[model samples]
Target: MNIIFEESPKEVADSATGFDLFQDRSIVAIKVNDELRDLSHKLSDGDTVIGVSIDSDEGLSILRHSAAHLMAQAVQEIFDPAKLGIGPPIKDGFYFDFDVEEPFKPEDLKKIEKRMKELVGKSQRFVRREVSDEEARELMKNEPYKLELIGLKSADVGEGAAEVGAGTLSVYENINPDGTIAWMDLCRGPHLPNSRTVGKSFSLLRSAAAYWRGNENNKQLQRIYGTAWPTQEQHDAHLERLEEAAKRDHRKLGVDLDLFSFPEEIGSGLAVFHPKGGVIRRVMEDYSRKRHEEAGYEFVYSPHITKSNLFEISGHLQWYSDGMFPPMKLDAEYADDGTLKRQGQDYYLKPMNCPFHILIFRSRQRSYRELPLRMFEFGSVYRYEKSGVLHGLTRVRGMTQDDAHLFVSNEQLESELTNVLDFVLGLLRDYGLNDFYLELSTRDPENPKFVGSDELWERATSTLESVASASGLQLVPDPGGAAFYGPKISVQARDAIGRTWQMSTIQLDLNLPERFDLEYVGSDGERHRPIMIHRALFGSIERFFGVLTEHYAGHFPPWLAPVQVVGVPIADEFGDYLQKFADELRSHGVRIEVDHSDNRMQKKIRDHTMAKVPFILLAGARDQEAGTVSFRYRDGSQENDISLADARIKILKAINDKTQV
Candidate 1:
């Protein structure tokens, strides 16, 4: 019989399965008729065959999934009667959850890894079996989570969704050479062919307590996370990257550098910046304001709360109500006889700044000369983020966004968007994030949430696509990821360790103007609707501060550093000289401090160095007499006995240039 295969057409000698179709060891699974299938899947004439290479995404997922089974088998060997939960492959790694007697310790991971190594060397075969629901219930009766998963197939469920989503239940058994089953687990798997295929490049990173199916209200299970690479070189690279990331973790550096803290008194997802952190934040905002002012932007301020009618007119009440805080009823009046005199109105904490900007645009009638009315604000918006998703600074409930909106005529949309892109990229480069690519989020035709005519949608999307492409950056498409009012182009930027973060966004809107009935008189003496372009450069000031903290590993650029210079006197006798220099620098708007404690000069240097000070100035008796100060850089290099004037020039140049020390 003839077959259409991915690489080449071929004929098989026997009535065969996918295993017979491709004998390459790297071919871990098969895609039969465009659907992923196990190696043991039976194939017939007229069927299409595509090999799943072990290094490809689908193949890696299969390998990791099979590795998860090996981990489960290992847990069964070392741990006493461990009950199975779900084992699935995640991005860059895999995890297996188990209902063990206790939380896994560091030693437990070592023991399980050792057993996994032994099992991988066994070259065990994975035998697949299909069973009726009754038989599956009987087989998994010992595992309550498995039975619960089985019941969830009809009622909607979680971890086991992968197990029963295909309309049937299947089990994979780790078979020994003697044809007896060593272990078994329920899965819908297109896993690696055998245990030997999962080589020695896998490592169980760590273990933690996780709620079953990620539901906090459910029972917590012990989950072990592990990563597998195609080669040892790749594994080592990943481990090195992990090390760098841990060193740059913003939360750790924040505390060590005395930047910011999340206090319980202020509630979860709310943070208070310390004096030092506030200094950095103020510098960031100051620079941003200067840049926007130079770019022809008008600064605007809006109240933190507004009547719900504004959101209702903007359609945010219909589209984004889920992310908005519940309303506050205010302004109700009562009579002395207990009869209601006036009705209360719903006032909501503003979750966005666009509606207020729209009001500003509509407040007065204007002509085409004011077409691109750029309005900027450091708008503080509140979001109702779930407690489970609250992260340090990056994900917060209260954030101040460097938000702006441009009201441009429809004819000026393209050039206005082009200029906005240029402005956004240039400003971000100032913050030291130079790596970027554009992600175009277009409307999903199948979804009704997006409100716009096809002509308007196509025009807006094409304008953004051309602008992004013209910027000479790669563009990735995100289908169905746009806001309800319009499509957007989000900038994805890479940090020092190559992890990408969504930094800024440029959204072209047509629906909101119509929803709010906004208009302006055009050159032809007729009323025409204006286009709205929403842009958020920092995404939020708090999130950007956190990213920069990690990007520089807390050694911020001199201009943005909280404490730019610290003076360390060799002894109490030299304090006056250093204090004079500190005062001079302070007069020049530099943040400088002179250490006059009884502690030795070396101790003061150590303290300032620990704070990540950009420059440490030293004044010893000899240097003070010679009218020079020693310059100790953050990296511990020193320039001995530099003249005071020359040292001031170099420090000022570094700060003015915004160069990293």
Candidate 2:
């Protein structure tokens, strides 16, 4: 018999098992062919095997999922009324939901953790056994959630298909040394060998209320989150990263810095930027516009609402109607008898800017000379984001997109797309983001939602793939992830904390132009359809603002700071002198302010520093007499009594150069 291990094939005994070959304890599981199997799985003839180590991503998921089951057992032991729910592993951790009578508080989490520690210390063995639906229901009759799952399994729908559709249901039971059962749960699992393996390197994060299956209409249950790692050092590192992420959470920093707020009156997912936040947004938009103007993009404008026919022509009504808000029936008419005279038209808030841009292209005749025509707009779009998915700024319903559409001839498609990629990367670099990679989203063959012929899609997809590959950056394939009308190359950027954010997208659309009957006259004097390239560099202003806030940890560079320079007088007497200096800076188009509040000098400095001001200019006795101001940087570094001439030059140069301090 031929057995493959570590990518090498050799003859071995058919009776050989994963545990016999993979003697290293770090090898948690075995991949037989393409399927993950337990280490105790026996090897068959002509089998390809690979080791799954504990430190790998898949290994960590299994470890965390096993921890989730152990935690569920502990919850049941500590809380008599607890009922089991689905437990799934997520990025960096796992969470399990419970249908308890009351929510778990902070103190309750401590009790659960204590019980978990005791369970781990028991060194119990985990025994996996398969049972019929009737037997499983009878065994777990007391647990309503489990019984409901058994019923779902019988019907083979929802999560039940995964729970038992494999022809049988499996339950994992913790066994005592005396061959007695401790605890068990219904799950489709490839768990760690024992509860003891889910060791001390795990911590319960927090508990929150979540609707079952993510449907708000379903019953809400309490969910507990936890993370598992291979070592204590790794666990500590994960915790430290979580702390840093919390500190940089944009929602908290937004309020702490007086940036933005979500008003209840304005409704959920709608934001109102305060004066400070408005300044930051204005700076961002202005800089982007300047860059676009230099890049030869013609600025365009469109209305907020339009007749539903536009979306219908763009095929958005068929493929994307669910994401759009319901339409408003307008232009109603009535006769003297109060009977309907004429039917009304349905108008919808524009969920996208592409259809409108297409209308502009079709409004007039075009020659090949204008084939590479680019149209730009800061178009605000609205999406019906469910309340459960909406977050601060990042996931808002209303957002202005820094969108552009480029039309090019078929022969010029590849070159124009290459240029667009370069333009996207360069503009993003100007915004202080350098780390990036490209994801090529292509059409799914099985889904009929994608419009256009295979030939058109292939040409569009290959052109984008070639352009993205030629950029010499990593390209990840996203199967079945393309827009219904075209394929897109989305730019994935890494933030300061090593988190990736979808910053920009450049899509190659061939269907919309054809659907809209957009054309240009070629040198051959023949009318030919143009290829439309849709690009959104910022994705949305609200989301970009959130990303920037968290990326910079609310300490924006001098160029983008809401208040570039703040004038702080050491004494009340020097207020006049500081105000004069602030006037000079303000005249230079700098965002400057003089603190005239009744707070003490140190208190004023503290207040401005907490606001994350880039520069704090202090004027005192000798400095005011010397006609110089002291410079205080965000990092608490200082330069005293710099000449006014040099100070202006230094500050102006930093702002112009976009320096971070």
Candidate 3:
């Protein structure tokens, strides 16, 4: 009998249990059917496969996931009878869920680390095998979470899921050289070559409680988080970066500086700003409003609550409803009807400001002269954030956005974006944040959440990238970070402590104009849709204020400090003299305070220093006679023997220049 064999590329090799076929020469991992498995899995002819390369994110995820399994295997070796849940890879790391009786103490982590090292030394290999659903269920029956996950497949992907191309599932097992299973997980995995190949590239970071499947209603499971890199040096660098992040944690600084408080009685995620914090926020907003006014932006106001019908048309009801607060039903009695009846009308607190601003633009027909119309508003919006995800002001439920919308022609999009980026960077620098990076977030063609057509998305994304490049900014790609309606450019600022905070965004919108049917009469005498650019320089006033407090370490600059100057008279007699000097400073547009609280001059100075007052002018008989005042800074620098007028001039210059005193 004569057998026919087809010629193929040199990159592929013939495999067993098949006709002429090419082996995965470059694919580090392969997705077989609905499951991800190692490329070593013997493939049948025409098996659906998606190759994963070493440089790809999916490949990295597999490496992290495999690291997580190794961690669990190590824990089981040290602590026998330990229950295991699911271990999945997340952004930049991987976490394993465990149902241990007690929380894994810090000491427990050390022992687990020791065992992991031993396992890495053993140079064990990860083996894979194909198993049916019944076989998988029997193997994972001891693990409730894994069994639950297997159950969720049918539910998560409902009947007629075949339309989505979800086929039957399979499982892979990990085995040791003795052919005894070291550990096994119910996962779709395309892992690394073996334990020895995993390299010295992972570290156990922290452990916390996470609800199963992220559902609070489910039983809470202990989660061990760990990060793995392709190289050991990268892992060490990441650990160092984490240490830097902890130093910039706003919550720690908030307590140290007495800037804000989140009392449990007041509620989680809701914060109360202290006097100092309020002053910082006021100055920030006041200066922002001044700048916006100078830039020809017209201010507008909108109510916090709106009828549900408005959101339904804006597509927020269907897409972002989960992030919004639940609606309240209006009764018939409140609607001018005596009978108590359900009106079937719902009202919701606004979660964003764009829809309201769109209504303003559509209130009247615009003309070509009104092109590039810029409208600004310091709008406060509320979101229903999950308590588990809430942090300090950075992840709050209520905050105000320095929001604006620019209605311009498609031809004006690039210039408008350029101006917005420049304006954002300029204002940020005023607060002493000079370093920045730009992220151009474009639409994901696979995701249907985005509203605009592909053509519009391409035009908007290209325009944003061009503007960012022209501005000489380092643009990074943020896939799937775009808003529901359009792509955006996120401006990330590095603070004084070298920490990055996402404080500004400029988004190009084409969906809203079409939804609202807004148009402007162009020079051609034809009704044309106006391109909208939505931007927020300070993403939120509360969040930015929090970041600023930590960035300055609570020692704000003179111009922005609530109390720019404090006068501490040496004795009771000199209080009157110092009061006059304080009044003079106040008249010069400085926020000055005179301390005569019956405390000693030393005590008063200490109190003012604690409050972070930029300038402290001490007056006594000797200095008062010479018409001079001894000046000091919050940093303990004293410029003695200076005339009061000269001291005032110096203080005013610092405040005017917004310098750190």
Give one clash count per candidate, in the order shown: 0, 0, 0
Overall local distance difference test of candidate 3: 0.79
Number of the top-ranking candidate, with lDDT as the measure:
1
Residue-level lDDT of model 3, residues 406-524, one tens digit each, is 99997888888888889889999988888999999987889988887888898889888989998887889999889888999999988876767888999888787898888999999
User: If scored against the real structure, what TM-score would every candidate get?
Assistant: 0.84, 0.86, 0.73
Q: Could you tell me the TM-score of candidate 1?
A: 0.84
Candidate 1 regions off by >4 Å? 1-63, 75-86, 97-114, 127-173, 184-193, 197-201, 205-224, 230-240
Query: Candidate 3: how large is its RMSD?
Result: 8.5
| Per-residue lDDT over 560-644 for candidate 2, one digit per residue giving the tens place of the 0 to 100 score | 8999999899998999998987899899999889998888999988888888999999999998889999999878889999988
Among all candidates shown, the one with the greatest TM-score: 2
Candidates by lDDT, descending order: 1, 2, 3
Go through the candidates in order and give each one's C-alpha lDDT.
0.89, 0.87, 0.79
Q: Is candidate 1 or candidate 2 better by lDDT?
A: 1
For residues 1-661, write the lDDT of model 1, one tens digit per residue: 7778785677764577888867688888899889888888888777889988988999888888888899999998888778888888887778999999988999999998899989989999887788777988988888888888877763555544555555678888899888888988877776777898888788999998898888889899999999987777877888998998988888899899888999999898888999999999999999999999999999999999999899999888887899888999998999999788998899999999999999998898868889799999999999999887899999999999999999999889889999999999999999899999999999998998778898989889999999999999999999989887789999999988778999999998878889878888998999999999999999999999999998898989899999999999888889999899889989998899999888888888889998999999998889988999998988899999999899889889998888888
Score residue 391 of candidate 3 by CA lDDT.
77
